[model samples]
Target: MYKVKVFVTLRESVIDPQGTVAKDSLHKLNYGEVSDVRIGKYIELTLEKTDRNIDEIVKEMCEKLLVNLNVEDYRFEIEEVVAQ
Candidate 1:
């Protein structure tokens, strides 16, 4: 079996309004040292072994559905797992 961990985040050039709001809120709550905040998505997927290239499969999934190519960037890690 294989386990995939996907991370999705806004591109550096893209503004993150949600992250900004969170940072502002933190500053208001006495976190003056907080310089920045970034919000992102983490996804986990479990799949059985397949003949297809795992990297290609993951890239396709991220491009087709998980990430916005225009404003977001993504990365993934694949790990082999032993089914219980």
Candidate 2:
């Protein structure tokens, strides 16, 4: 078995309105130095079958579905499960 962790984040120069909202909230709560905030999603997947070669497969999935190549960037990792 293998574990895959996926992370998706907006590229720099892209305005994140939601993040801006969070920053505003922070400032309201006394976080005056808040410069910016960004949000992203983290997904964890348990693959039924995988080995050392899992890296390539996970990379392909990220490229094809997990992230948008034009506006968003994504990264993922695959790690073999060790016996407990």
Best model number under lDDT: 1
Q: On residues 4-81, what C-alpha lDDT tens digit does candidate 2 reach at each position?
A: 889899998788889999999999999999888998889898987835467777787788887888878888777779
Cα-based lDDT for every prediction: 0.94, 0.84
Model 2's alpha-carbon lDDT is 0.84
- TM-score between model 1 and native: 0.95
TM-score of each: 0.95, 0.84
Clashing residue pairs for model 1: none
Per-candidate total of colliding backbone pairs: 0, 0
Weakest lDDT window of 10 consecutive positions for candidate 1: 39-48
RMSD of each: 0.8, 1.8
Deviation of model 2 at 26, angstroms: 0.7
What lDDT tens digits, residue by residue, belong to model 1 across residues 1-84? 899999999999989999999999999999999999989999998878999999999999999998989999999999999877
